[model samples]
Target: MLADLRLITVQEYHRMAEAGILDADERVELIDGYILKMAAKGTAHASAVTRTEQLLRQLLGNRALLRFQDPIRLNNYSEPEPDIAVVQIDPLDYADHHPTASEVYLVIEVADSSFQKGCGLKAKAYARSHIADYWVLDVAERKLHVFRSPSQDGYQTETVLREDATISPLQFPNAIAIIRDLLPKLRAE
Candidate 1:
């Protein structure tokens, strides 16, 4: 029943994806040296990601690069692909290797079936690596929980955001995203 039997490093995982060892059709991701079978994107999950992406792309413009479902190298053992990641401005950064946590400005995981995993496991991993910011987009709840100020344990700041709220990146001063516009079909009630 297990698709991946061998433990692979971050580098190896990328190489495998690069070499077509795993096809695009395979719904899977590498996390903490283990290949995890990701749940198929339900309707709600896909909608959230789509709306979020549109808002982010327009807000960030040319200042930051927007990546969707891309693998980010956390470390030797961990390289989990977040739903969306705003990375540093670089033209050739992803040419030879995946972006490290140091290169990431923010990571967003749109959680549907993997809500616990995103809020718990991935949050800890991002924090341990000193990731500047992380957001859990709760599809079921139609809200975003922002996490920032990484410490030895976890993120120092945590805030819940609704559709009417505005979100600004910790790394970028001028960039702002309106939560309501980002969730077009979401109802606050």
Candidate 2:
């Protein structure tokens, strides 16, 4: 007789991560029954995420919420750490529990080596959970890919934002961000 494999809950996954058992630089996510290592983010990816976070914090002020590279629980089946997430309000109330898709206003993934995974797998997960908006910061292509109108399948609306463009969150009608100003500054290090 064959027995079915046990699926780990989102809570269990967090306990392991919080215990500091995983390496500091490890890129990991709990998908299905296993803990998987995601593709290591490159410098461009890191810089782009940083720039976006800074800009978002400045523009939003204390009006909205912000989280950098935090785990978002899509459901019982998946929990992936997105690059940056902008929520409607401060989330300090939920201490250990991961923020569900309903808690998020927008999810941004700054992509370099993990572009495909971020754009594909993560997009689907966010969509299924009814996340209002999703953005993939394409560091290599130097573009911002916006995803909206999510369904069970995925986003029905997708667009690539160029340097001259400004992108705004659908949740906040008055808020807007300049793409050119938000892009990662080229630095020799």
Candidate 3:
């Protein structure tokens, strides 16, 4: 990191948006104090996100609130919109502010083209926030990368589950998610 590099705080980021410096339709997120452009979502990415959201909704049934591509407050310097965010239901539905780390149950990133960023920078960011649980769905490989046991260094436990495997959020053990259900079915060529 450059010693002299300026880092933008979350407040400044919001101010930039409110001032129209950052357009509402811009595909960018504040990460480690820098605004990073997000990768374009392809069909596989969109489908996987939809499938995961739909299945989680069906299984969770209001036990948790799910937000797709919505910003989650990680810290003063970083706010990223995970592909799917499983959060605690608030009476206000977070109308006043975005869900913070403590309010989040699970953060899922569909890795269509940003797998490295998801498992790397984002992982560290989430771990540092003590978010508890993070998942990266590798659409191309048809695998689910689970990150748990968050620490300042990053997730202590990392597991890669194939489509045939299953998982459940640490917060809601009863709401099990079959890995296959979260991924798009492979179409025959």
Candidate 4:
């Protein structure tokens, strides 16, 4: 016999958080109406995220709002907290709500243990939301996976850049980031 699983909406997810059902320290995101526990950040992953955050801030400056490890409301059933989100500058600083797909210029996820999910489910969700630019910093391989031209099925364009390569956001073409600069240097064994 098949079992039925109930899926919660984004609204319900928020309500659960507000109601103390989901603690503040709980690292979870609503994905496809399911609460997905985010992977614990390792030293390398944390370092990479910090480095990427710094680089993005330096390059974007006042041109965009850079949010780190914050929720971007994708749809009614999904609200994934990406590692770095390049958003439109809002005077109110998005006090009333999280950045939506339209407000977001780029979403970046720094992946160590979550590489598969980052490039698979996360990518699909972002693309389905019509997010134009999505990037996954693969910590294990030390590469940058860039996804663009979103369609309902998935991103139409996918590119992988090595450490020696550089990439710039489609919105801010002048501000470039070397792939290596945004990643954590592997320690010498």
Candidate 5:
């Protein structure tokens, strides 16, 4: 006999959180209707996230709202919490709901071990939603993977930036970020 699997929607995910079926301490995300546990953050991963957040804040200033380690509703079935998300300024403050794909300007994920998933499944999901820009900071490799031109198949453009390279977001062409500034400096033992 074949076993049946149940898929949960974004609404149900919120309800589960509100009803305490899911604890606030649990690091998990809904991807393709499955709740996947996020990997624990190592020192390098944590530092990179902090650095990226700081750099984006300084570059964007009041022009965009930067959300760190927060969930953005991708669609009816996915709400993956990105390391950083640049969203449009909303006067109402998104008080009623999370920013959807259209409101998002860019999404960044700091990947140590999650690099494969970030580039594969996560990239496909973001592309399906037509997210214009997606970036994956590969901590182990010390590089940045930039994805753009989203389509149903996936992002059409993929660019990998080394430590010495710099990148500017499509939304803010004038604001530039040195790729090295976003990665954590490893101290020699």
Candidate 6:
């Protein structure tokens, strides 16, 4: 926590939206009680996200729910809208409430400019919330940053794989995803 800043809870975050302090279109989220503006999605990042989603959907089918750029409540102070959240299949499709950390199987972030935040602060929040599988697709660098073995401190294991590599989420071991497919014609910006 920073000494100079005041932190707001998730409840307050919602209230701000209702009070018009925050707009519905605002690209912001609550991370560790801090209201942080999310990075704008670039062409490469958007394409990567769509590709990853399609691949995961083909693999998962009716097994897991795939949420694209949707909110998942991590804690009292953290409710981030990850690029892709692979969660359990709820009968009501999570209409009752937002998916929580425990319901999440894998969290993926497609990043070009926000690569650091995806692998750093966001990764730490996911790890602390016991998200066993967290991946960051580095659109600019054309790499996959995989984080596993979560702890209160952070992820115990962190691996960066190249575009030629293959990866499988913790929940869906047999469903392999190729790194190259996740980033097609990616270029640094």
Clashing pairs in 6: none
Which residue segments of model 4 deviate by more than 4 Å? Answer: 1-3, 187-189
* Pairwise TM-score winner, candidates 5 and 6: 6
- Full-model lDDT for every candidate: 0.83, 0.80, 0.92, 0.92, 0.92, 0.92
Residues 19-127, model 3: lDDT tens digits = 9999999999998899999999999999998889889988889889999999999889999988999999999999999999999999999998899999999999999
Model 2, which residues run further than 4 Å from truth? 1-7, 15-25, 32-34, 91-93, 187-189
User: Native-vs-model 2 lDDT?
Assistant: 0.80
Give me the overall lDDT of model 6.
0.92
Residue pair clashes in candidate 4: none
C-alpha TM-scores of all predictions: 0.85, 0.85, 0.97, 0.95, 0.94, 0.95
Task: For candidate 6, write residues 1-189 as lDDT tens digits.
Answer: 468887899999999999999998999999999898999988888889888888998988989999999899999999999999999989899999899999999999998899889988999999999999999998888899999999999999999999999999988899998899888563552
The TM-score measured for candidate 4 stands at: 0.95
Error of 1 at 174 (Å): 2.3
Which digits, one per residue and each the tens of the lDDT, describe model 5 over residues 1-189?
Answer: 224888889999989999999998999999878898898899999999999888898988999999888899999999989989999998887887899999999999999988898999999999999999999999999999999999999999999999899999999999899989999986761
In terms of TM-score, which candidate is strongest? 3
Candidate 1 clashes between residue pairs 3 or more apart in a chain or in different chains: none
Displacement of residue 136 (Cα, Å) in model 3 is 0.2
- Model 2: per-residue Cα lDDT over 14-109, one tens digit each: 677688877667878876446778777677777787788888888788877788777877888788878888875645655857677788888988
Rank list by TM-score: 3, 6, 4, 5, 2, 1
Question: In model 5, what lDDT does residue 78 have?
Answer: 96
In candidate 1, clashing pairs total 0
The true-structure Cα RMSD of candidate 2 reads 3.3
lDDT of predicted model 3: 0.92
Model 1 residue 74 distance off true place after TM-score fit, in angstroms: 0.9
Better of 3 and 6 by TM-score: 3
Error of 1 at 170 (Å): 0.7
Model 3 regions more than 4 Å off? none
